[model samples]
Target chain A: MDLSPSGAWLVIVVASLGCYALKLAGWAVPARWLEGERLQRAAVLLPIPLLAALVVVQAFAGDRALVLDARAGGLAVAVVLVLLRAPFLVVVLAAAAAAAVLRAV
Target chain B: MGIGAAVGAYGLSFGAAGVTAGLSTLQTCALSLLLFTGASQFALVGVLGAGGAAVAAVAGALLLGTRNTLYAVRLGTLLPVRGPRRLLAAQLTIDETTGMATAAPEGLAGTAFWATGASVYVLWNGATLLGALGAARLGDPGALGLDAAVPAAFLALLALQVRARSTLAVALSGALIAALAIPFTPAGVPVLLAALAVVPLILRRRRET
Candidate 1:
């Protein structure tokens, strides 16, 4: 929230460049090196935890405190929708709606 | 076409989320245009929106983007572009395009890849702009429960990647670590520490070998 406008722009530029570089590296690097089982496993395994961490931090944490409010309800709905194999947009919107409804009541 | 439409709709949320996270609309659009990766873009904005430092936000996002490289590696072999065209191929080598390309009939793979990538790019960027503008006008994102939407989006992305018991185990561990770390550590650090969840798996594998 305290982020300066320039700071935000810097993040946009740096992160975007880093991501593009990673994508290009994939194309340039030899397939044999990346195709190794261990390296491949690391790649596949890495994002799983990061994403899971994000889910927890976003849903449960509140400014260095774990406080569950409407977001939890929203996330619960998201879980259910995901289990039901709902579309990506549906899952996200349904979660938001669930939270809004919970907060309203 | 259907994939593009679905992804485009999701882009609306990204745009809205970026604004909610405190980015100017131009900054948000810049992310969609330059980063072009859905989960990483969301992670960056999500971290920034939550008041995390820019360094942490960039770290989390860059980590998330690494998977795109893996996608590119496979696509490089399958498609085998030679020179400057490789730049376009690498840029378009995202999850959706890779999925469509890999799944297409042998003769139609190239067509499928280009069509899906280009269409999704257009639709997603257009929708991101729309969502960002609409959200900027809405006022009070909490009233609409948009705050919760961020986590929900992450959950959806996470759900897609969890197919094995080990991956699920890792996910749960990551969640626990992040939740535990939140109260003690800084905002972005918890997510970074959560990546430590893999240590147990690594140790276990080491023991087996």
Candidate 2:
């Protein structure tokens, strides 16, 4: 009952179209509208919160209940690497290794 | 162009996760080619991987995608692209391309955008296929801790953007909202609703100056 092939394809199609529409809509927005501080601030601030939410959800989700295990350790390792300004690949591998090692023990 | 491999690495994780989440390999590759943003693609698969409803997955993905619209708006003034080229520019308006283009000297922004975007597209799609094909052999990404890749990747991305005080505040509040909602809401709903946590701060800043 998860995303089937057909279902996955549908989401891809809709997401592509919707994403394009957002680009077009951005152009269509009047310069006057963007002149408003609130509208502009919301645009800038939106991803910060949204991506944080994604990080939380992805780190903790488990079988319809929230739990933390190796994933948290992985996320923490990622935080340290990222703060150290590790390259993107380094951050990913170290994080995966951290999680894998934690799960192994 | 060298940075396209960033997309490659990110795409590989998505491929593994998408397949684990029950999407076919073709389906996962299609996502990389079509939707083309790492965060949104991850949001869509993260939900489905958890066996959450498809509607919830779509909702979360689309909301995350709205950020691309802001990127589009920011790029418009810089690029001045029009007609068919505008569409092409829009497709290329992901984080890497925008960051590169924005950082370029005034006249080179367009070149930076295209070069970065095209390289990412080619490498990312190819890596997606590789990951999808390899997924079955890899067993559970969760066991390998590949599941943690999703959140860790998001944190890495957030680390880049959270330098500003306002952004850090929004991120903290958003995390709080999502953490609180985890017990009460469905799997993907916390992410979608967490948008509300930032609204007041945005509105308040508007009132401030």
Candidate 3:
């Protein structure tokens, strides 16, 4: 957590501008590139794996160690609830409640 | 509009997480205002909360934000705007807005995008402030186990998305890569590298062809 306030600001600024750049990049490209096979494939396949990566890292990794605590339990519960097709808020709050209750016990 | 506001609840979580990760209240609100993407905002705060590097945070957010680019490309033709107007569309070029625009009947694309985008932006940012203030008052976040909320939410989303065979394969592969890589690389690196699952996807597609 050595991030100075300024350093955090820098990251935010860059991320915001980078987002704008991506949006502009879409418009800047000829319509052909968007229709091209390679980009299309990327658009389709990239999010699945990328989102999976995010879920794995967030769920499993804790302080550089993979610890299965309440978070893991909560994640499992959330997945099951989602499979059961619960509402979005119910899924989220239920997961958190599961984690909190598990931690308390 | 209700969906937009519901998505806004994500802002509440971001506000809390950002504070837990050591950002000032002003800074957290500033992120909600400027970055305005839930996943990216969460990535920044998540990486930092886990003591990951700032650069890694930015990289992860940028990676996730690329989805908006895809949205933009798809929405570009449908939205009839240019110059300054195009900028408005770009600012609103997010998952919800693009989704709304795409699903709208015929000529209603512009109305759908603008309306949903405006509601989400306003409600999400407002909810962020309220959540931040509440969290700031709650003192330490660990007491309530709010730390678990982010990963749990992401897990819920993954569960919904991974119903198909191809998605399941990619998700499992990505998880394996991240688990294997965690010990050696920096915190966020493994997550980004998991995108290498794309390689196998491409190879499979080629073989099918």
Candidate 4:
């Protein structure tokens, strides 16, 4: 792959700064603002959908249409492991193994 | 737990991608250490891989990173830093760290949050360096479906977050937005959209009480 050195560096710098800014914004803001009843309630519930959407996209979206091949299998295995309340290490290894098998076969 | 593992593994793939994108081992490690944001790093590399303009890729990453603002707010309260600790704590703040911290029982929240953040930082940078060095021998992560690891891991994380009452609405909205936007948007954009879609639901839920 042909990567431009200067270009990549620039992206890294800007992205890092942007990330820092977001973190700073939260810290710099007054605590009372976020502690409001309504915002607090919203915060508790917000990760659900945002994380759900991420899961769906990761499991299904492919270069073409949705693929239920190896990736999906890996996801399924991870889901089962999670249900069983397995340790994080086991779940990751199992998911990766499932994905590898599905992709190979 | 699931989200942490899955998201962490995604770091491995990002490491692999970083190597393929012509980043050296040191540079890749630096990226993970400095940026520490998976979505942004992935977006940066994805754009490079696709021959997209560098500036556009950076912009895409910045846009995706907007969600961290939300995380920072929640985590700030749970693990408020004082004196010089603030600087280190701020660097450690990420989705996983913040999530673990915010979810933790009050007294234990600070410790759990720091542990999670430190662990992720160590694991991510270590894996990236390893992946960069091993990329050649690794032989096609796509063929191995390593890319799937990210979404799979994220899904597991999402599953853990589900509870009663609001589960249906949150799940449906996330699925709808992700499915619709995945094809149109770039790598980090879908996550941003997912975050944006939740805003109205959050606002509406607030109004109900």
Give each model's whole-structure lDDT.
0.88, 0.79, 0.77, 0.68
RMSD in order of candidates: 1.6, 2.2, 1.9, 4.7
lDDT of 3 by residue, A1-105 (tens): 458999989988998898778876776676667776656776666666766776677777866677787778778887888788876667667777788888888
What digit string (tens of lDDT, one per residue) describes model 1 on residues B30-120? 9999999988898899889878998999999988888888998888767758899888887787889989988988777788878888988
In terms of TM-score, the best-performing candidate is 1
Report the C-alpha lDDT of model 3 over B64-134, residue by residue, as the tens digit.
Answer: 78878778888888877778788777877887888899999999999998999898888878888887887
Candidate 2 — what's its lDDT? 0.79
Summarize candidate 2's per-residue lDDT along B91-174 as a digit string, tens digits.
777878888889999799888888888988898889889888888678877678777777887887778778877778889898
lDDT of 3 at B49: 68
Error of 4 at B173 (Å): 2.1
Model 1 misplacement above 4 A: B202-209
DockQ, prediction 2: 0.66
Q: Candidate 1 chain A: minimum summed lDDT over ten consecutive residues — where?
A: A35-44
TM-score of 3: 0.93
Displacement of residue B125 (Cα, Å) in model 4 is 2.4
> Each model's TM-score, in the order given?
0.95, 0.90, 0.93, 0.70
Candidate 1: residue pairs that collide = none
Docking tier of model 4: it is acceptable
Chain B TM-score of candidate number 3: 0.93
- TM-score of structure candidate 2: 0.90
